[model samples]
Target: MNFQTSFPSLRKILVGIHDLGRKMAAGADLSHAFIMLDGSYGGKEIASSLVDEDPNSPKGMEQLKVRKPPRQISIIRHCVNTALLANSAELDLAMGPSRKASSLDGQSRFLPVFRSGSCSEIGPKTYMEDEHICIDNLTDHLGVGADFLSPGAFYGVFDGHGGKDAASFVCNNLLKFVIEDQHFPTSLEKALKSAFVMTDHAFADTRSLDRSSGTTALTALIFGRTMLIANAGDCRAVLGKRGKAIELSRDHKPNCNVEKLRIEELGGIVSDGYLNGQLSVARAIGDWHMKGPKGSTCPLSAEPELQKTTLTDEDEFLVMGCDGLWDVMSSQCAVTIVRRELMDHNDPERCSRELVREALKRNSCDNLTVIVVCFSSDPPPRIDVPKTRVRRSISLEGLHLLKGVLDSNG
Candidate 1:
């Protein structure tokens, strides 16, 4: 029978059969075979196959022989179609399209899709002082109403200074505070601010953790189709959008004008590019040793500045990393490397691992932590845009005039 033209839906079944045959040829043992044929058609068999259940088969022995019955092919076709339909339904549920692509102002936009991966490395640092978190579904814990805010995701990278205690504490408890705040599930900005301040104060009150240790916090919270990013230190967040890198957080370096002014106004100094000649970041969490008396304001604040934008299809993924990665690679360079790796393997975890490896190759001396949150099921597709060219020519008359001026000067 010409199964190719007569039964187009059986293509996958045939391919599966071919694969099974290859496995059998490669020494796979089969234990049983069952064939059911219509008894109404004189009990004629439509198909039959032999299986060797013996475990002690000799080399090159024939274990399977498929027999084609003289008639009743219709029974075989019906069985195959039934099996194929079941498999097709499963495949549709597992690998079906989940995102809707739209357009906004001539640019492609996609609804937010939740898929994230993370990787961290000690690199050349004496200890792993960096930490990160990936909450795939915040609503699962927050129990927020859909009308107030749809289910969301969160990614954060913390870079510790002085020690790892602060980093560890914040990594484990920051999200908890954020969700438990009274304003949570409604006002994310207010909730995030209160969480950071509360976490900082809580750490300060703790006598077990190192009081002098601090960590830079950078977080990306995705609620529905909107993304809200907040940062309180040198840790960074960069968005990969249409093959370009867009920074979402500013590094809180003491040299920055705003940081410098804030530090000096709080009776602090930015001497030798360091805040108060000690810390390098002007903002952080759990640097209680550098802060003023409990109620008074301090130079090294834990308040994070927030940036919010609606996510679109053009936004590929977000890279949240410690300063260790940024120390050796520019944001665009990191994005380019990750984008290329994602295109090759479509694995965000692998892409983040590659970023850490690249930073190590460039001689970064700090602990590295990176989280990549993809906005779609797969990595962003590469688009090749044509470059425009311009040509300019000088007229003969204009050339003669130029030559006359040169000759007169000579």
Candidate 2:
């Protein structure tokens, strides 16, 4: 069944801000769902008509019958007075506002994403096992295009072993490289491959400073309707889809055939069914000592499996973490807790903190990293790719366009 109506201006404006704020506050520990917009769902017309049109679109509209009268009335009012005004304000801001702000200067129509949260303790052990990084600048955005610019957003975790060098290296450069790659593929798969290889080489280049630094990486990239997920090592990604846990990525281990083959090809040995008879993980970013034989064709292959999935309403949120959090919590258990948290708190990052707290409570022994990607709001439309694609360096000028839209709408 379908029901159509216009949203009021003010209501539209506020919905955007309220939704963005909710997302920003959510961080990594919450569940989210997106609402799709049909061609018939006219924001401007809805905004203008909602103030006067009957709350009931059609007398026999069965769907409308099920909705509460107050909610229906409020929806119309919201669309007109807030949503529409905010949307217009955003567009005006994007186009370059001529006048100074007045009563509405403080108001933001677009909703930003939630901030991330974390915690750690000094255990009796002489060393530290927990590691983390939270960049609010990146979390609140997706990406932006001509038709619809998306806010750029990503989350990641690196579980370090041997030492903290690996994990720390990734947290510092992974996102920067991905965004800066001149050859970053428009396709998620290709882009991810490029990123993995580039990131590996970047580490190798840094060997001059510290050859032992390497990390296990699990990253989630959210842009438009595509969610690009890439992973190497044992870090895992599990999705909470419609309240059920769905494993989205594989955990590479020593026993896996691919890992075994790669290990042997790189001149690395497996003893006691372990990588070099030490680490149980088959794939990892660093560990030069465990890499290729003196002069073999094999090197520390950091090949990552890149998956691109078109998001839908059924897609809720994703949990990406080092084994620390996963070691202590089952996918289902994590989802349940996050789902409950979202009920009480709509922020994703706050949910992330709660996850870390839960892990610490369970006494996870490894350094922990967690990245959560929530599909809570309607994503902007896909960018149109020109038939004759011209590659241009993404520069400050190009980036400004993104900032402009985000500042206006997001």
Candidate 3:
């Protein structure tokens, strides 16, 4: 068959396979077949297969569906590998030789090591209500390379409201709860979810902690090449890739439609863009005063929405910061500043400091905390290309006409 002519179809098939792999990894029932391939590719006959099991043999298929833990992990890894390979192949075909050559140069290089830096400032706020944590080596405390566990990094930014107690408590105890969860390292999503709930409950149980105080949480956990982000409230996490800013977390504000619906459903009201006219954030760690009765759900939920994405060569760095920075600067603007700083200084710490400084210069009123996590060993190298300006030579007749017009005007 002519592979070049069938490339597009082949790419689509690979994408479908990738999607199926992800579904299987997520524990979706695979007994029922959903995909159908009945058409010909490059004049070659294609076979069709049913993904669903036979109606008469449901019990047999059910028995086969019980996968062992190791097998499950293997399937997920295989799916991820296949998807990456397909994507790389598609990219290669889409790019011409010149583009491919450029990719081989330093312009498309991937980092060999991961480094992180953080800075926090009590801006115009009366107190330092923002807290952050950076764990370079998560495995230092957890054993190295256990079954599903791999060495990774943990980073978070907690933006406090009402008081600093909630932020401080979450910053100190959240990671502990994540690592200690029964699903740690295996099912990352479960581990993170359990960790958030556990942290909320732990804070609520503390008699000394102020129940009226609360804080928004944004966390990024990098395990191997996979990233899992959990966010509650308005703090944000942005990823820098190829000079572009990609947001990894969503702000949980009271005005958001989804949040407003949930709040009203729970018999809570939003007034002037604040939850119950008191807190601007719809979700948080401690505001026990706004919660419903014990064992009952509340409009002000502590639950966080999670996001997952895999790291690639194109990914550069990640910026986690409180809303103070975002209030004055956009995600792309921040990425541009950080990229320029990294290029000039080759220092993530300095880059973060510059971000905080820029936010203060813009007149942010809240406390600010910024974390810059670089995927490279050193700050990303500056790619300096000379500028090309277009110039045109004037004809003799045109020049004479221009001179005549100038003389007339004078």
Error of 1 at 345 (Å): 1.0
Quick one: how many clashes does candidate 1 have?
2
TM-score attained by model 3: 0.67
RMSD of 2: 21.2
CA lDDT of each candidate?
0.75, 0.59, 0.77
Candidate 2 lDDT score relative to the true structure: 0.59
For model 2, what is the error of residue 366's alpha carbon versus the real structure, in angstroms, after optimal superposition? Answer: 2.0
Residue 399 shift from truth in candidate 1, angstroms: 36
Please write out the lDDT profile of model 2 over residues 1-410, one tens digit for every residue. 22223434546635544654575577622111111111124555333232333333563233333332442332333322355568767877876654444323433332334334444443334555435554444534323521325554566767666666766777777776776666553555666677776676667667444546556777777655566778887888887665566777787877688777777876777777687777777766766666653223453457787766655655667777777767667766666566556656666767777887777777877665666666664322222345556675653323433443343333
Error at 319, model 3, angstroms: 0.3
Better of 1 and 3 by lDDT: 3
- Report the Cα RMSD per candidate: 21.2, 21.2, 20.8
* Best candidate according to lDDT: 3
Candidate 1 per-residue C-alpha lDDT over 109-149 given as tens digits, one digit per residue, 9 for 90 to 100: 34577777889999876887888889878766456553434
Flag regions of model 2 displaced more than 4 Å. Answer: 1-125, 129-149, 261-267, 293-300, 377-410
TM-score of each candidate structure, all chains considered together: 0.67, 0.57, 0.67
lDDT by residue for model 3 (278-310), tens: 999999999888886545798888889999987
